[model samples]
Target: MRVRKLTFAALAIATALSLTACNDEDLTGQADPSSTSTGSSAPDDAGSDGSGGSDEEGGKGTVAGTGSNENGEIGKCRTDELEITASDATIGGDTEGTVAVEFKNGAGRDCALAAYAGVDLGTDSGMISAERAGEPVDTTILKDGKSIFFGVTYPMNDSGGSGVRVTSLVVTPPDETKSVSIEWPGEATLPVTDGGGSSVKVGPMGSAGQGEG
Candidate 1:
């Protein structure tokens, strides 16, 4: 009878030990929620056009001029009332291959221009939109003869000597949808291709004080 009681006691202890081991295993095997990944990988063609793989992909909303629509006192500059022109800008007393685009109020009235203007380069493939460089500054008040300027920075050193020749520029004034296609001032060319490092950055709009040249 004592042997039977000892055997029963050993069986109960073995069962208790087995359950404790299973509980420990369950606690250790649980996955840490913080380390688990959530999102999928980015597409292979991401940032191919130098758009940084965001909402600016395929050149849509590349130069998001959001701050331009805030001023309602002087009214936004209309596309037809503004005369747009481009010229080779001399950066730091030397032409560092930058283009200065000028906007003048030719409609014999006063208008306002704020934030970055939408810009795109005319290439062989299609229009390559420019990315916004810096934040918007003060509103540019354009009188009949006054002008506002923005600079376009691009890679100009064509090592292969067969760069993409930029023939024209598609410009959209602040708060306007109608774009104007102006011939690229001077023979401007980029050293990169369409899908390859073909990046173009545009500064915000400002008067002559904002480094127009």
Candidate 2:
């Protein structure tokens, strides 16, 4: 009987030790080093790739039709926002006459003007063939209230004594459809011949204060 009691006591003590070990482990809350984290491992609002925010929300990048002049530099100049003017016509020679043309940006932003300005002597005469006089000019950027200038040289005399009758000059800015008209100076007439293959020449556009041709 005493031996049976000793065995029972030993068993009870062993069971108590096992329970205590389990309770200690539970209290410590140890985690396996190799186990992956179960809590949401997803990325935050910035996105995992790192490119975040939008111009629409006033964040990084340029907003459409607004922002710094550098950002708007790609936008073409609009006709409605441009102010076109022509200097007094000058007779360079019996065959050639030159006129200085200026385009001012009246819009409240910066814009790009490129290529050659389309020139028309009259409504029915169609567009006159023109070529750039010199090397290609750098792309012009016109800021608000700024202006760019170029020269247009045309024939002053046709095969006959009569010169090209130009009542008004129609001008179109580069890369634009809308055109503006300036009344031809009464003293100047192009010497180009009727049905002749002669062509007018235009110089590269440069900033204001550049000498006129």
Candidate 3:
């Protein structure tokens, strides 16, 4: 009787094991056709490599839109800055008078002045000394003396045009956040030598030129 009981107990355990070894569907009901194979969860597919593609990437990377300016020179100093000072500076324009403007660079990168254009040495400060267009026009940095324009405001808008008299202008462009403005007064003298080789002297309106009436 003890041997039979022992055999019965072994049989019961084996039967339980066999039942558990069968498929889960067999234990419950019919297998769901639409159910995933292996009955495990599926993997996700956000697809993006998360590496943020390069600007010139053809397709492997996901490109994005960014803000940019055509005329903004706030970034690295452009090689063209020196050129603009010597000629048609969209930065500074228009001046009236025979005056000499010298530039002193304080630090940072190479740079020029952005000043008012067409500022006649004959006008008094109380009067509308000069007109400034949009923003001021910037001057170019040059190794030698630069021939540039100043103090005349135009129809458009820019940072390179501020119609105030400036002298001994010390421009510190190499600084991180540079502040561009006139520190001292710019003097206006009569034309001693014209680009056309004429001895044209400026007539002061009581306040523009040097001492004496």
Task: Sum up the clashes in candidate 3.
Answer: 33
Q: lDDT by residue for model 1 over 1-213, one digit each (tens)?
A: 999999999999999999999999877666443233222223334545444755455345533444344433677789999888888775554434678888878878788787889999998756789888866677777777677788877766447686777778999997889999998874566766547544788888852234432
Reference-based TM-score of each model: 0.58, 0.62, 0.24
Which residue segments of model 1 deviate by more than 4 Å? 1-72, 91-96, 193-198, 207-213
Best-matching candidate per lDDT: 1
Better by lDDT, candidate 2 or 1: 1
Which ranges of candidate 3 are over 4 A from the true structure?
Answer: 1-41, 45-97, 100-128, 131-148, 151-213
Writing each residue's lDDT as its tens digit, candidate 2 over 1-213 gives 999999999999999999999989876665542233433343453454355444334453444435675453368888898898887556445446677788888888878888577766662345555666767766777878888887777765545645556667778899899988887643445554556564677777762235322
List pairs with backbone clashes in candidate 1: none
Cα deviation of 54, candidate 3, in Å: 18
Write down the lDDT of every candidate, Cα atoms only: 0.74, 0.68, 0.33
Error of 2 at 40 (Å): 13
Clashing pairs in 2: 155-191, 156-191, 157-191
Tell me the RMSD of model 3 versus the true structure: 15.1
As a TM-score, model 3 comes out at: 0.24
TM-score of 1: 0.58
- Model 2, global lDDT: 0.68
